[model samples]
Target: MHRPACSSYLHQLRRRLLLLVLLSAISAAQGHADEFIYNSFSGADLSMDNQASVIDGLLRLSEGTDTKGHAFHTFPLDFSNNPIISSNTSSVPSFSTTFVFAIISDYDDLSTDGLAFVLSSTNKLFSSSAAQYLGLLNSETMGNESNHLLAIELDTIKNQEFGDIDSNHIGIDMNSLISNASKGAGYYTPDGEFKNLKLNSGEPMQVWVDYDSERTILNVTMAPLPSTKPNRPLLSIPYDLSSVLPNTRAYVGFSAAAGGIPTMHCILGWSFMNGEAAALNYSDLPLKSIQQLRAGRHTYKTIIIVCAVLLPTLGIAMIVSATIVKVRMMNRLSKSRTTDIEWEREYGPPSFTYKDLLAATSGFNDKMLLGRGGFGSVFRGVLHHSKQTVAIKRVSPESKQGMKEFMAEILILGHLRHRNLVQLIGYCRHKQQLLLVYDYMPNGSLDSYLHTQDHSTTNICWAQRFCIIKGIASGLFYLHEDWEQVVIHRDIKTSNVLLDGEMNARLGDFGLARSHDHGADAHTTRVAGTWGYIAPELARLGKATKATDVFAFGVLTMEVACGRRPIWVDGANGEPVALSDWVLAAWRGGSITDAVDTRLDDYVEEDIELVLKLGLLCSHPSPNARPCMRRVMQYLRSDAPLPADLQPDNLLRIGVSQELRMMSVERPMSCPATTITDLSKGR
Candidate 1:
């Protein structure tokens, strides 16, 4: 009887121990379900779109120029409840995420837009754009509260429109590209010292982001890879995510974009949890994968070097002899043929053979022609070697004036690089035909969208128009003040502003652009440019200056805002009404916003008023009264307030009244006699 009781007690104790072990295992499983760790994305479950790919176990967000990429977690996380929060507290869950990323670019000091860690309601961002938009939002959706988005951006480009602090920065974005709070990419040490880190250094770096629900605080920390997290966070802000994330479920992801620069954004490791994220092991990351990718580039460089050194000496001698023989034959044929070699040596841009250009353009077929202008016809071409689409402008062989314009474009655009400026790739000359190649703009000219009567093309919204206005201003600012020399864009109009694939404005047509040393007098004496865009001083003095460029920009601004050309015949009276005069009249009548593009039904009233008033100020008859491009940028960005004395009466007192009165009857007295007609046609 005593032995039976002892056995029964032992059985009861074993049953209780087994039940406790089962409970512990269940709790562990629940914890794992709420978190994830990806040492490498080789087999990780991720939703990718566009250019995003998993290459060599690395999660590459973007791989090439003018592309956007997105990668998101396969499952959504519930943010409605927090384990650490009390019943009366907010429902938004506290979370932490850590990731190691790298930005590799072909250039050492330059890169396109950067990447962002995003928490969005949906994983599909198909409508997002590349470049400064960063694949998170487009011009239409940016800054809208309905987005319900939260992002931490590591931006490598400084966009003034978004109020970026610098090129290398980490910002907290709430439903917009404009950051709520931003800091230079850096961290403070334990001893209260700050150190800067370059985001596009082509090296791996780690970032940590944590949110505390109780305190409603967000902390972001970063450090170079393989280093311990700094004690102090780089950016700490007191904000509630509950407002930005209205939905209970959110998908975490990464979005990146590249502009004209070739860049690669990659992520090596990632960890995220509802609470504190698990620490990532540096050694476990797939560092060797990206290393090998970089090594491949190095191998290509080595091959190029070896080829340069190992060229057969005998072969080189034979080639030199053949070149001498060919030159002798050409000399015997005609001395005039030697001018081609001299022209190539003087203008130091890459030269393409005539045969290659002919092949690229399919022998200049009519179907390949993009548009015809006064100077030349532009043809769309695909280069055989690179498979790159380019615009080839073939100058008219018989037109003596076309040669001057061709040389001007080559001398100016070949040496310039800016986001808003069309890039000149190379030049070619065969017989009497002059060829100039430029990066292709797919969306065509801004004039087509603004003034086209074709129902097929969609009307540009007010947001896109505003963006184009700012883009043109930024490019003009770069030309007038930022560049080494002062460049006066003699022709600044809707037709000259080309829209790229993303509809970003690129000021092209530099045939009339004149550059001079800073603070030196302009030597250009010819009064050139379209009729309405020509400045008053330019017509009288036959000189181009930065102020003249501003005047034309002002006219273009009002034209864009009002959705009318600078000069259009009034329907009622059949008399020509200048765009500037009409806008000024609207301002005087206390209905300036009414002059805005009628096609646009939705827009910020204040922005419309600001643009109209700024246009008038810039178009003032006296060049001295006009603000510089720098001040214009500040006014557009609202960094500085418009002048208190700026009014229609004040402008009238400054002689604009007389000028407009003169210009009201079809053509003004100051209009240049040699103004280019049909300037609105595509170039």
Candidate 2:
């Protein structure tokens, strides 16, 4: 930690060395370095601009210096290859003034080399300062740096200052790191004010430096490439940036010091601009820059004009075009999509275009598959121009899930977004060729882990299982108790719970769900959901409510803990037994531990019991008697007490006990893409 702090201090110390470059960037933004091109390898032509000196004789490629001493002896600096204009006025805009350089180097040896962007009061090069080595210090075989330059070196080799943490990178320098280059080892304005520079990187790093000589303000924009927009230059820095050069009329250049070996890199090309001091400090200007900018005043004016005139006209045209295209696309969609869908009651039959889905799922290639559902297959494809990957539910023409059910789902799910609920990225309505695009979940559903043979279930240690439980609970709690329109996940099963890379669970596929509010009655619907997980009360009154989901979740939780299918034909000992009935009978007999999975022996005995109790709560036969998923989570995570146990005598005594079978697909459910009709009453 202490060494880390020292490095931080060193970072702070070294940054001040670039105060000259920072200040020059600022000054140049006001048109400072415009006079000399960075390629002036010689010291004669520059007017103390960025230490930019013009050298008539640099080590060209053919006339290279392989010697140990006087190392700037030879390199390919075709005056044409690397040109910077010296003794010239810079017409570069105040906000736009900057130096650009292209550099290429073929190394002779790891000669301890680097290139520097220097901003100094003296334009003279090959002079004596820091040992008078012309940016190359010492009479050694490797490298050298100059004392007379305030430089920003993009060094390639390790030095005595820092280590290899930053391999082949950029740095700031002032004189010799001795007294003359960086006074006080910090930055300070001539008037005693303080400024600092911050550095970070992105790809294809583009650095924008701004210097407002009026305020002696220096700022830098350091970012790698690929950002959507350029970032702001961080100012009000972490270190003082004004103490590099004692004089204002200094030159800018590069410096490298090598004692043993030689390292080579070069400035292949260069650009320069002269800058004048701005009246206001660059830091103080909120109007963007000294250059005349209309962004501030014209922002709303331009938008308002577009909205008032162009927007309405475009909107009408767009609407007309959309109507015509919608009919055609819908017709095309009907051709490919099967009519075996249960359209939503309110929205009528789904009208997704087949061509749109074709485009979205890349023609339903195996690669685009999302997952297979009880009804049909889900595929991932992009919308035409949006290029967005949507989960396209292609209802099989011969599937059991009906059309109205799909519509019912769409009416409810289309308007949701939650942290634990997968985002409904977009949807399509092509006659029967229904399709939907959601924010893709590359990580498969929870079933992938819990039921996989690829060493998945065993790896889901207690921590991961706990997280999945909590995530599913949060999502269900949102659907059940949080939303204004209370959503009831009629079918809450492990397969519908999607998992992200982090194993965060997203409760999805609300095909058998229902929604209501405080003022509304729970809806009456046929018993729905997976065979082993549907609430018992659902088969009787056909009423679906929030408790229904809680029951399903409870079943899922138990399956997770038990590490077995929800139902089994015979007990391990060869007796007829349902997992739920077996667990209940044992609970009644004070032998609930019999229901816990043997594999969970490492889990705390009490934790297993807690999970068993939750499962019982879900398997409760009466909808009115079940606790909400919210309470389930509270009991799971918090110290909340469980509700009193319900006696088995009265549970589901009157429902379809005489004869009820699962797979009662009453309402025609459409594909997960077009409609959510699966939750409604059966025929």
Per-candidate count of clashing residue pairs (backbone under 3 Å): 0, 98
Relative to the unseen true structure, what is the C-alpha lDDT of residue 442 in candidate 2, on a scale of 0 to 100?
A: 68
Q: Kindly list the per-residue Cα lDDT of model 1 for residues 1-683, writing each as its tens digit.
A: 69999999999999999999999999887656559999989899899999999987799999766678999998888765467767545567888999999998765677878999999988999888787889999879999998888889999887756878878999999999999999999777789899899999878899999988888899999998888889889989988788888788889989999765567899999999988998998888989987876776567556644544443333455557577766565444443433543474456423577898999999999999999876779999998865779999999998776888889988887656577998777788877799998989999998888887853444788889889999999999989887767888898989889999999999998988889999898888877777667777776677888899999999888888888778755678755556788888888898888788877777889888889999988988789988999999999999999999998888845344346455445444433243223333322
Candidate 2 lDDT over residue span 469-499, tens digit each:
7788888877776655788777787778887
Root-mean-square deviation of Cα positions for candidate 1 versus the true structure, in angstroms: 9.1
Structural similarity to truth (TM-score) of each candidate? 0.65, 0.45
Superposition error at 99 for model 2 (Å): 36
Q: Could you say which candidate leads in TM-score?
A: 1
Alpha carbon deviation, residue 68, candidate 2 (Å):
57
Best by lDDT: 1
Candidate 1, residue 504: Cα displacement in angstroms equals 11
Candidate 1, which segments miss by more than 4 Å at Cα? 1-27, 298-302, 305-314, 317-370, 378-488, 497-545, 554-625, 629-683
TM-score for candidate 2: 0.45
Whole-model lDDT per candidate = 0.82, 0.48
Instruction: In model 1, state the lDDT of residue 596.
Output: 83
